[model samples]
Target: MTRLNSAATAETQQSWASVLRITEVAAGLPSSEARRPATPAVVTLQMVLEKLQAGWRWVERKRSQQISAKRLRVAETISLGEKRTLSIVTVDGSQYLIGSSAGGVQLLTKLDDATPNNSRDERSQ
Candidate 1:
């Protein structure tokens, strides 16, 4: 009976000592450090807007380059009067003379490697 009493008393004292040590450690820390809450990193609105603008500019530049690098381009257009027009279109390095009027569009001719100084009379056709 006496041995049991002593063992119970020792267990209670050991538990109280552990509690006191924990309290002392907690007290040693700064109040701010102990109470600070965990939070995600903050991002400013200006920073986000700047990033968005940079991305938009990049997209616009790429779109412009793609448009300018297309395989087909109209080199020149001449109005023949009375709603008629002739257009020189370049496709994959080849040039074509197209005639358009109120009737419809027609492929006038496929121009050879002729310089721009040379002229052709469409009236003959």
Candidate 2:
């Protein structure tokens, strides 16, 4: 508290000095001074949130568009079960097999499905 009071007193005394000509002070002013406005603290927070939300929406739209491109780059295998099934794949590299055995080739379609790709053969149905 004492330290703050001493600093305040020093600052008060220092303000008495006109350290420069008015013209010199005007010339030294930063260019941004002309753009300054008396914005309330809540107004500043609102402006920041608006900018953040706009950027978030732009990112979401861009990310959704990239899904198909990323899907094209992936080449994964699908499996069918034990009776030795055979299938045909589409022109777009999608697999389709028609076979039904108790333990044979299993058809895998989505990437998020954690099916076994190691023991599968690649002849589309």
Candidate 3:
């Protein structure tokens, strides 16, 4: 009788372990096969250097694009008097004479592509 009881207990424990394993699978836990160690990633110095160079090239390209996109620039500025000044600004391909005082800035005139003397004459008039 004791022998039979021990056999039954062994069978019950085996069935319980199997049921727990099935429950774990249903709950999306990693199985023994999926828990195996993954292959190590191999990185070389050449790989690292290549990645760094590509990153620098991208940064340089972006910097050059930003510089090229600048269409407005102050060509020259002159002080007219106290709190007053005159400036020549270039936008795209056109130049403009700007006046700045304590109150605000004003666009005096657009300078032409003619000689500097002619531009000055036009501004004076």
| Leading candidate by lDDT | 3
lDDT of 1 at 44: 50
Q: What CA RMSD would you report for each candidate? A: 30.3, 22.3, 27.8
Q: Give the poorly placed runs of model 3, Cα more than 4 Å off.
A: 1-43, 117-125
Residue 100, candidate 3: Cα error in Å is 0.6
TM values, all candidates: 0.52, 0.31, 0.56
Cα error, residue 114 of model 3, in Å, equals 1.2
Give per-residue CA lDDT, model 1, range 26-65, as digits (tens): 4465888767653343125334444555565676699789
Which of the predicted structures, 1 or 2, would earn the higher TM-score when compared with the native? 1
Model 3, poorest ten-residue lDDT window? 38-47
Off by over 4 Å in 2: 1-39, 71-125
Model 2: ten consecutive residues of lowest lDDT: 15-24
Compose the digit string of candidate 3's lDDT tens values, residues 72-104.
999999998989999999999899999999999
Query: Residue-wise lDDT of candidate 2 within 1-125, one digit each (tens)?
Result: 99999999678545422222332454355879746663686456555555655565576588678865453322423354444444443325544433445665455443332234633543332
